[model samples]
Every structure is written in C-alpha cells, then in structure tokens.
Target chain A: MMKNSLMRNVPENYNPYVSSDDYKSKKRVLIDKKATNSTVEYLESYSDLFDKLNITDGMTLSFHHHLRNGDFVFNAVCQEIKNRGLKNMKLAPSSIFPNNQCLVELIESGAVTDIYTDYANGPVAECISKGKLKGEFLMHTHGGRPMVIESGAIKIDVAILGVPTVDKKGNGTGKIGKSACGSLGYAESDVTYAKKVVFVTDNLVDTLDDYQLDGKYCDYVLKVDAIGDPNGIVSGTTKITKDPVGLKIARMTAKLLDEFGVIKDGVSMQTGAGGTSLAVAHYVKNIMQERGIKGSFASGGITGYFTDMLEEGLFEELYDVQCFDLKAVQSTLKNTTHHVMSGSRYANCFDDNVVDKLDFVILGATEIDTSFNVNVTTDSHGKIMGGSGGHSDTAHGANITVITTNLIKSHMPIIKESVTTVTTPGADVDVLVTERGIAINPLRTDLIEKVKDSKLPIVTIEKLLETAHEITGVPQKIERSKEAVGYVVYRDGTVIDTIYKID
Target chain B: MKRGTAGTLESNDAMIMVKESDGLKITITSIVYDFFHEQIENVIRETLKEEGLTNVEVICNDKGALDYTIKARLLTAISRMEEEK
Candidate 1:
C-alpha cells in the first residue's frame, strides 16, 4: 500500500511555488469572434444537436455549471452521449457538484476517459480518488479555467450551456424564467472558444431586455421541458454557521481584519460559499455597518447575504458571476447595481480581474500545513472530494487572505505538518484562524506587527498542531498510489501538486 | 443491565450500544477507522478490563471519539445494564 503520512514536498515532475512575483503567462486560446449568423437552428432534441455537431470519440464536450447541483442539462446531455455508446469523451464542466452523480457511471463505463473542472464533489470525486477513472483529471481554479481554455491548453469541441431563459434570436438571460440562476459568467468563455455553442433552455421568450448570452456566439438552441431547479444553488452548506466553534473562528477573523485596518471604507473582499466563510462575511458586514464603511464591491458566486449588503447601500455594487441562493437571483432581477460578469472578468489574473482588487478575502480549508499550504482538494485519507474553485485565485490576489476553520474537524486536525495536496501555495497565503488559536505566517511580518500586543490567542502554527494532536492522538498513515489520478494546477498554469490514487 | 446505550453519533463523540453477552465482544465502525482503529480497539478492551466486566457486547459507532470518551460512555452503559438487573 502507498503510505501517505510521510513529510513530502512538491513532486519532481511539478514546479514548486517560488514567489507570486515569479509568475509566467499561459497560452491564450484564440476565438474567431464574429457577428450573428443569418441562420440559428432552434431544436428540441439532444440527439439531433449531437448529430449536427458531428460528435465523435474523444471529443471534448463542455458545459457550464450555473445550474449547480440542481442542474438537469449536464447529466441529461452526458446520459444521451453514454446511451449512444460513445467512448473516450472528455467531460469539461466548469465544476461538478454532487447532483451530477451520472459521471460516476460514465467513468465506470469508460465513456468519459478524461475530466477537467474547477471544482468537484460527491460520488464523482470519490470515484476519481479510487483511481477508477481511465484518464487524466485536470483540476483548475475558477480564474485559471478561463486562462486554461483561452490559452488552447484544453480545447472545447462543443459547449453545451443550460441557460434559464433564451430569446428568439438566441439571446439569453440567467436572471429570468422558472429556474433563473442569475449569471452566465462561466459559460461565456465556453461560448467563445467552443467550435459549436448549444443553448438549452426550458423557457423561451420573444425578447429579453437584458441578455447575458449573445445570439451570435450560439450555433444551436435546444428547448427542453425543464432545465433545472433554481433551489439547487443552495443544495450544499452555504448558510451562516451557527456552530459555536465556527462562530468563534468567524468573529476572531473579523476582529483580525479590523485590527489589520482592512475594514476601512472602500474595502473589497471575497469569501467562500461555506457557512464559516459566510459567518466571517456576516461579521465583516457588521463591522462595515458599525463604521459606516461604504465599500467598493463584493464579488464571486453571490448569496442573499451579499445582496442584502448591496441593498442597504453598504457596498456600491455586486459583481455576480453566479447566484448562490434564490434571494440572490431576485436581487439580480430588481437591483441594477447587482451586475453580471463573465468568468474571465471575474478572475483571469492576466488582465484586470475582480479577485486582484480584493483587499481581504476569507476562505476555508480541509487541511493547512505549518507553511500555510492549503488542501481543499482532498481529505486526510488522500481521497478526492473538492477542487479549488476560486481558493487560490482570491488568495493570490487579495492583500490579506484569512483561513477560518475549526481546529478539529470530525476528529481530524485541521492543521498538519504538510498538507496532502497543495491547492493554494503558502507563499500567497497570509494567516490561519482556528478556534484553538490564530497563526500568522512568518512571511507576513507586517500583519504580525499589527497585532503583536493584542488580546487574541496568537500562537505559532506548531503549537496549534500540538494541541490538536494531544486531543485527536496520532493517526495511522493512509494508503496511496504512485500513479497520480490528477494534478492541482495553480492559477499561473503551473502544476503545484499531484493527487495520488488510493491504493 | 440487560441493555444500555450512551453518547451520540455526533462528531468527536461515540454512540455505544451495549447488551448482555457471554464474553467481551466489541464491534466498531468509525469515519477515522483507517487511522485510529487499533487504538480505539485497545482503549475499549482496556476500559472493559478495568471495569472488571466480562459479559458484554459493545458496538461503537465512532465519529473520531477520544479514548476517555469511549471509556466514559462504556462505563455509563455498564451502569445502565446493572440498573436493569
């Protein structure tokens, strides 16, 4: 069995993270952008669309994840492909949530030989960890996804998008219809890069006052009976955490931000769609309100909580790439200040992006090493569970990136000597906030000096690790494999870590 | 005691079910079983030995519970078994 408890660094094949200043540019995928064609086929069948696209074996088919876990189009399209006995097809969805469990079967049947995505969870993730996948799994960050595709490293044969509403000319809006998801940010890159773009919608209107998807980019439109449920956006946990441990960490992180003077007026921040992160946002919002701080904007997959801040005039605008809740979708419908942006505009570090403008950002972790390298990609057992959606992007861009999590999660220490996989390099990371104690990175001397004489429980990361070890005891080494199932690609288009298969 | 149960299936806790058995038998299922299974088994065996109880069956649904928690829960179940007798 492959032992996994040893102190391992970046593998030989991969480039170790040196400094964010040492970053290099990636390949730029070329798109032949043109005006709207005279003829746009509006069809009602997936089979016809596939046939029209002339899909063959090993073709790279892509999809947008705006529908999230409630999405019906991704599974439906993949199922049709499987039913046609297609093999070696490349599945490149922006991200895979739990509801897309059809992928588990697709992998098992050898129908999907390769996979590329920003994030993945549930059965598909578990399946990949077991090494059952027949080919390479390319894990990209939210921002890096735009980079990877635009650079031509990962090409799209066809882009199948599940939009909520589409007008007669193929103009689409994600903010209206029965299953409005609020933004088409992720699908924009696909529509531009893919050889053919298919817009699948259950609702078709004669005209849309504001459409996110331009008809010129779309080659075909599929009108389905139902696209997906809007409610699935909140299928996973994204509520403000009520757990005392979570609340404590959030409060401490907010206090740290205040002490560091990051909570001043015109501050720009981002947080993960997790309860702990949202709790941190909640605390930050309170701080903004108390100080009458009118921040510039909040960005990413926005939730109702963020909209509430915008509605109350706390922030000037909301940069929504995707909506996380129904309230957020409603906010987009009514609030003009709540704007829609493409994925590249949201976080493509090569050009002007939202994440780069962040003053401070709050993130969560499955494991964080003493060096501050994080692993939101795998569990302690070296199993695939999640990938970096925007973890590294925000961390790399934000001046202060705070990681908030419980010290002990389900009897496992959140702090480790070395993480199983490095999703975000330690060089970009700023601090770690746990319920037990807060650890400031040695590299961040400026932050350390800000709270040197504070009442907060500031301890070395090693001390926090010792406290956790004392409680959970030393766990046995987990089994792993020499054969890597996938690679965690950094925002800079460099391979940072390899996820070994479970032996 | 004829039968007893203690603790909960919550994280960092163990839900232990105990019933009358001719000899000591412990069956465990845990989320962290890969890493701490042997240590968990040893703790349960030692806890039983210290209690001077031989006739018992412990089924521990462990969600990464510590050694002391296992001992305390087992002890409570043992006390409940005696209360029934």
Candidate 2:
C-alpha cells in the first residue's frame, strides 16, 4: 500500500493510504547561466524530448489547467507516452477539464494509473467516480496543491507548462498570444517545484522584452503548432444571469455589500463566475457607479465584467489568477494594471496571498446545510465531480464569505439539513443569499446585528431549511459503498471530508 | 379570444403564456418545481384573479423566478392578451 506521512487522519470511511512519503526531489547541481546570445535549447518533437528524457513507468507527470478545455499539451504528452508504450505513470494535473477526457484512454490503457489534482471534471472525473482506475486519486485544494508540492510531499518528475506566447530563450507569457489565457497561476507551483520543467508554446515570437515566466524555471522549450484552441482558451463572453430570481438574490447581495460598507472606496473583492456571482458583479458595478466608489483591486478568476470594472475606473487594478473569458484575456495583454499572479500568491494559505486582502467574495454551492457548511465537491449523489480550487481558501481569507445560490435547483432544495460533503467549514461562511431571502451565519453576530434592520428578508437558517423541506419533502440520503473515492483536503492541509464511492 | 406570452427561457427567470380557455386551469413546469410549485401557482392565481379572468389557462415554465417576477410576468401576459382582444 502507498504510505503517506502528510495524510491526516481523514474523517471516517476514507482510505488513509495516499502516497508514499519517500519523495525525493530531483537534484539540480547548477542553474542554467544566461548566454551572450540567445542560447535557448529546443527539441524538434515530443518523441525526441521523451527519448532524451527516457521516461520510465510509475513516474509522476504534472500539468496546469489554465487553458481549460482548450489545452493541447496534456493530450500531446499523453499521446507520446502511449506511442512510446509507457505505463503506470502518475498523472498529476492542477485540474482536468472536459477536453482532458483523453485521459480516460490513458487510464484504460494503463499508461496512467494514479492521479493527483485540485479539481477534475468530465469523463476522467466520471471514470474515477466509478472506481475504474487501478490506483487511488488524491484530491487536494488549490492551496493544498502548492503546499504539498513545495513541502516535498509529492515530488513531480516532469511538469509540462503550456504558454500562449514565448521567446526563443524560453521566456513566456499567456497574455499576448492567440490562445492567451490571462494568467499562468496554476502552473506556478509545478514550475517552481518540479524536477524538470518544459515550456510548450504555439506563439513563438521573435523577441519578448518581458514575459511573465522567465527562462530560469525552464529546462526545455518545445514549440507546437497550436498550444490550445483559442475558442476554448477564452470564453466568448461572461454574461450575468437574466433570471429575475437570480437578479433579486444578486441585488440583495450587492445591497448587503454596500450596507456593510464592503463596497466603499478601496474595496477588494473576489467572485466566482457562476450566474449569481456574475450577477453580483453586475449589481455591485451599479452600486459602485451610483455611489462613486472605486475599489482597490479585484482578484481571483476574472471575467469580462471585472475587466470592464477595471476599465471603468470602478477598481484601480485586477490581480487575475485565472481569466474566465476573452475580454479578460484581452485586458491582460494591454492593460498593465491587469496583473497576472502565480497560484501561490493567488490563494495558497501558507503564503500571504491576495485572498487575504479580500473584503468580500461571492461564491456558489451545490448544497449548504443549516449550519452553513457548503458542499461543492460532489453532487446530491455521492459522486466525485469537483474539488476545492480556492473555494475554501478564499472563504477562509475573505472578511465576509457570502454564498449566493438558489434555495432550490433541479427539483432539489439547495438548503439541506446537512451537506453531502463539507468542503468549506460553516465557520468560514458568513452569509447566504437565496432567491427567497438571506440567512446570516450565527457566528457572524456582528454582521447579523448590522443588517438586522435592513429591508431585505433576514431569516434564520432553520427557517430556510423548514421552507425548503416544506417545498421538497426531506430528500433521501445518498447511498455510498464502503470504498473511498477521494479525500477533500481543506485549504490548510487538513482532510476535512472523505468522498465515498457511489453505490 | 386572445393569447399572449411574456418572459424568456433564462437561467433564473420564468415565462408565462396566457391563452383564452373554456375553464380555469393552470399548468406550472419549473426547474425548482418540487419546491416552488405552490408558490408559483399562487402567484399565477392571484395575478389572474386581479385581472378578473378565471376562464383562461396559464402555462408557466419557471426558471426559479421569485414571487415578484412571477406576478409581474403574469400581469404583463394578461395585459398583452387583453390588448390582442
């Protein structure tokens, strides 16, 4: 069995054997010195690169998911491995998206047996959900990912970073290419900690005066025809939900932000890209405009709306860790105030990150219990779908963590007696705004007292639960087998919950 | 006899279609139907009653619309149906 020293005692029903603690960092005797000329080394093809590296079985490979559904590096590297007849390699990616379903074939063929990730979705996630893989999966949070990698708990053999634009000397940036993806935050840890790092890019410019990633972190530079699909690299648009109910919830959330003085001048915020969160941005923009309030910096997964705010002078700057759409990508290219940040600087709890400076954050959830505990990792059924990619991290860091979601969704009441899996502890969550009303966590007595006389409906979480139950009769508890699929590690490196295999 | 419709198939909104019917009957389909079915039905009923029309059929597809939006859409649909007549 794989042994792990960093693995905390997971809350019942999970296999504690994560991975062996015998992680040996790949030793580097010397750093590459700058040459008089551009002495950057390049590889002709993936075959040549793999042949030179002599990749063996059971070696761990790492990747970042900044490109989302557009990335080609993962597939290209995996296809090379398959062609080379390699097997049992541990696939460690920051996250897996719908386009990474090619990993299903890699797992089925035994090219990849083990997986480590902060998040996983699509076919590969489904494969792991069904226990189709030969080995266990280690699900870490965004902050936990860099923590483990940096602490030498999970040594990476090779990390392949895909960039949008690159120079001949391996200097690269995701901001100025056809497939620009805003920030390379998720790739930061892998580049810094991996034994070997490769820079793969499609837009090889003649010369780059400055780049986000310097050539110092790279060992090899490979040029591909297309690093990723630009269409998928950036969404065409990030529109707020037009649903009046969603609008109402969003309006109430904005009102609370303003009432609580979270929307004043020099405010800092982080909001997810879910419909309601986007709507919150829209309404918050209106409030900012109406009040003549300008914010200090807006951070996290940025969308066009946030970029528009930056341009409109609502916010002075944007510390983008990930761009959610094309407009955000465009803003990063030309706007110096729109800065790209590494994952460690973005939300890693071990470091002083941007999340620590956040005054307010708007998030979404699949389920929230009466205690305000949130579940975003699994569905109503006990299946593996998502992992915490800065969910709990921002929740822990933000001054006021607000969860905005419909009270009921897909015929299931979102307000449950207890969540299926506690991804974010209730103590970190401060408020919940639903279409029906708003419920403040009792722990935040200060906020409750402040908003007590607000025109918005202020109700107890128990009352919300009662209303939900009255609507959708108490739902049956999801069934699960004795087998554990994954463990949900909190932002601070503790195993808060264990995901059981769906029965 | 007149027929009118309001709203769209948006993420968090609902659409209501009011048609001249022989009897008072309301059909509500929603993403959150299990929880908000009754509340949505009440909004439609009260809306139609205020319009002084109990002989019309109401077809509503809800996308988690709040009570106010539901009432507003119902009233708008009724007003359009009246304009058609």
Candidate 3:
C-alpha cells in the first residue's frame, strides 16, 4: 500500500472513480526533497549512469515530450536499459510522438510492459491499440497526469529528462541552446517528486545563472553528442488553413465570440495548434484589430502567430506552457511579458492554475455527439490517432469551451449519434462550431440566450446531426472485440469510457 | 425586369434585386442555401413587410451571408427601387 501522508482517510491502492468536485479537494502528498552536504558527482556516461542507478525490472521511469518529434534521449536511455536486459518496466511519458517509435522494440523485448501518457500518435499508439502491450494503456489529460502523480497513485523510480542546456552542477534550462525547445514545464513533477532525477543534454555550459531545473532536484547530469534534431523540435512557423470551408467556419466562430461579449478587453483565451483552430486565431486577430481590443492573455501551446499578436499589441501577455514553433521559443526568451510556467502552474487540477480562470478555449474534435461529448482520441474506425493532451482539462476549467471541426471529414460525418469514446463529457463542452452552423449545449442556457439575438445560426446538436446525416448518410458502425484495450480517464481520475480491441 | 438592384458578389455578402409585382415573389441563389435558405427567405420577407411593401419581386444572390447581412442588402435594394419610383 502506498502511504499518503496528506490524506488521513485514503484507502489502500486508493484509485477511485470519483467526480471532479470530489477528486479536486482530496489531500495531495508533498514532493520529497533530497538534502546532501557532500560533493555529488554529476558527470557520467549512459552505461555508468544505468549501472549506478541500478536499472532493474518492474520499476517505473518517466520522460518528457518537450523536445517533441526531435527528441533522441528517450531512445538512447531505453536502448541502454534494453542492452542491460531490464524487463517489465512501466513507461510514463508526458506525451509520445512518432520519433518514439523505437519503443516498439522495447515493448516486444519485454523491457516495457505498461504505459501511461497524456497523448500519443503513430506506431506506439497503434501497437497499444492492438493490445500488443502487456497491460492496458491508460490515457490521461494534461492536468490528470500531475494529479495522479501528486496523489501517489503512480510512483516513479527514475526520471530521465532530455534538456537542451545544462551545467556541471545539473542545473538546466530549455531556453537557450542549439537545440532549444522552450519550457521544461512538463518535466517539473518528475524532477520534484521522482526518487532519482537525471539530466541528459548535448550542450554543456559553464554557468548556472539562468536555469529552469535546479541542480537539487537532479542527481546526475550526462552530456551526449546530440539531444534532439533542431528541425524537428520546433517548426519555423505555424500556419492557418487555406480551405474556404475552414475559413468560413473561422469567420463564424469569431463573430460568435464577439456576440458572446467575451472578445472585449481583459479576456483570456487558449487555442489548439490545429489548422482550423489557428484559423480562429486569424479571424480573432482581425476582430481585435478592427475593434482595437487588447486581450488580457493567450495561453497554452504557444505558436508564432500568437507571438506576432503579442508584438502587435493585440494581447497584453502570453503564458506559454510549451513552445510549438521557433518564433514562440524566441519570443518567450526575448519578451518580458512572455512567461514560462511549470506544468502544475499551467493546468493541474489539485492546485490553482491558469486554466481555472480561462474565459474561453478553442479545441479541435475528431467526433462530437448530439450530447456534446467529444472524442479527440480515435478515428471513425476507433483507431488511435490523437489523445486528450489538454482538451478535457481546459474544457473542465474554462467558462466557455468551443469545439471547432468540419461537419464531414473525408466523407464521414463528424457529428455522430455518439462518440467512439468520450474524452470530454457533454457537461464540460459549451458549444460546437462547424462550417454549416453552431450548436450550443442545452446545458448552457445562458449562452443560448446570449446568442439568440445574433444573426449567426444557432441550432440544436440534433439538428446538426440530422444535417450531417443528410449529407454523409448514416456511417457504418465500427467493429471491435469484447475485451477492453484502453481506458480513457477523465482529468479527475474517473474512467469515463473504455476503448475496445479493434481487430 | 423594371426593378432596383444593388451590391456585388463579395464573399459573405449578398446582392439583391427588387421590382413591383401583383404579389410577393422571392427567388434566392446562395452557396449556403442548403443550410440557411429558410433563414435568408425569412429575413427578406420580414424586411419587405417592415417597409409596408407587399407586392414585389425579390431576387437575392447570396454568397453565404448571415441573416442580418442579407436583410441589410435586401433593404438597400428595396430603398433603391423606391428611389426610382
């Protein structure tokens, strides 16, 4: 049984299906600190680090996706572990991208058995969806991962962080380096709470003046040839869609935002990095320029477009959790108003964060049902393609949550009778805007009444579904096995839906 | 064909033509007609009735305009037709 010093009435193996209200108020364990007086040796090779750390079977390890698809440290560490023949270890990454496909060999060799992550794409997710993993794949939201770890539900034996710059004393930062990927926010918990923390980087500097990760949290620091690919870490720029239909929806969305009266001064917002969602930013930019309105802040996955808005005085500040493009990285380092925050400060539900006070958030959805439940995890056939990185977290926290997607994607209707899996509950979602029309959740009578006078089309989700069916016809149901392969856990740690095996 | 016509083919805006007739007759061509035809026709009819003109022929070429934008365009055409009276 895990000992929770914060909660007095915690059950053994305390994992419960509780509501957000119940879960958010639970006691959380404080992070353990390591105080050592002797001079600690920080430099080591991969083999020496592994042996000294006593890499063993059935232990948990963590990694962060701040390096994104350019990351090379995860594969390097796993390779060393596999060479040492460690087995049955659990892999908890903040998120997994296509570059982490090397995990396939690690899983097949029995070196990795269980997996937990906020988001995943490409081969690893496909392998997990096919039940190739030894245990069920547990999916979490961006906020939920920190929540579970702080509650002592999952303990990490070691946390290997891939940083861009580090000193001899193990202090590190992702702000300035040849392979800089701004904001080491996602790895904050691993360094703070893990039993052992290791910093692996390619660029070694002599100074410790400006560092995001303090040397106290990290036990060892290792320098390598390359930590990540520069081209893959951050794109040159983020782009909006050229599709006319997408632009039309973006226009309507901007108009709707104005009608809601939240587009004025002091409004706080967060938008996804999708094409359509970025298009919403473009239209919103025009509206702000036209009205001379300056927003309080724009947060979340920061892109170059947002940085441009900051320079143009469209937004007063930009709160960046992760930098998605080069311009965003440069802006966070250059601008005083562009602030870098830890993951907990960004979206953890147990503690107060920026998400709790957001006025609006624009999200992308793969499927949305008549009840306003959303599925950003799977495709029409229930294959894993995306995950709830922060979709559910922001929706749960924001005053108004709007999902933007085309009515039909690849000849299949997006507004279904029900989603393949519910990533964000209907109660959290406030509105859905497609190219055809906008549907406000019946639960938000305040929004419906607010937009009732606007010329914008306000219709029921049922009406949108009917219109979709009229265009695409009823889609064929997806087939899957009876056994469950994955579990979609809501941000509060409740199992909202089960994903079946697709074979 | 004796009527008043105004506006252009701008995106998200509408062009309309109004002429005298024995009864109210309306024709609409819109790229978004499938989703908003009823809305466009209602706005056109309401605008004509609000101006106390019942016997008229209204032709609207809508390029996905909203209800209010369509109504404003129709009213502009109605006032133009009255200008030539």
Alpha-carbon lDDT, every model: 0.85, 0.81, 0.82
Clashes of each: 6, 1, 0
Instruction: For residue A402, give model 2's deviation from the true position in Å.
Output: 0.4
Model 3, runs deviating above 4 Å: A1-20, A31-40, B1-85
- Write model 3 residue lDDT over A7-112, tens digit each, in one string: 1122243353444455657665555444422223565788888888887898899999999999988888888878888889998999989888889888777789
Residue-wise C-alpha lDDT for candidate 1, range A356-461, written one tens digit per residue: 8899888889999999999999988788888889899889889998888889877788889889888988878899999989999999999999999899999999
Question: What are the DockQ scores of the candidates, in order?
Answer: 0.72, 0.09, 0.02
Candidates' interface RMSDs, in order? Answer: 1.3, 6.2, 10.7
DockQ of candidate 1 compared with the true complex: 0.72
Across A1-503, the per-residue lDDT of candidate 2 in tens digits comes to 22223322364433432321111222312222222223557878888778766678999889999889888999899888889889899988999888887788888877888898988888888888877778757778787787778777678888888988888777788887777888888887787778877888888887788577776767788888998988888789988898898989999999988788778889999999877899899888888888799899999999998998999899989998888998898898878899999887887766668888999999989899987888888876757778788898888889999999988774478988778777787878999999888899998999988877888888999998888767645655534576776677665554667677764
> Comparing 1 and 2 by TM-score, which wins?
1
- For candidate 3, the clash count comes to 0
Of candidates 3 and 2, the better by TM-score: 3
**CA lDDT, candidate 3, residue B17:** 91
Residue runs of model 2 more than 4 Å from their true location after superposition = A1-39, B1-85
TM-score of each: 0.94, 0.81, 0.82
lDDT of 1 by residue, B1-85 (tens): 3998899988889988888898888899999899788888888888888988788899999987888898899889878877885
Which residue pairs clash within candidate 1?
Answer: A27-A151, A28-A151, A29-A150, A29-A151, B1-B81, B1-B82
The candidate maximizing lDDT is: 1
Q: Model 2, residue A201: what's the lDDT?
A: 86
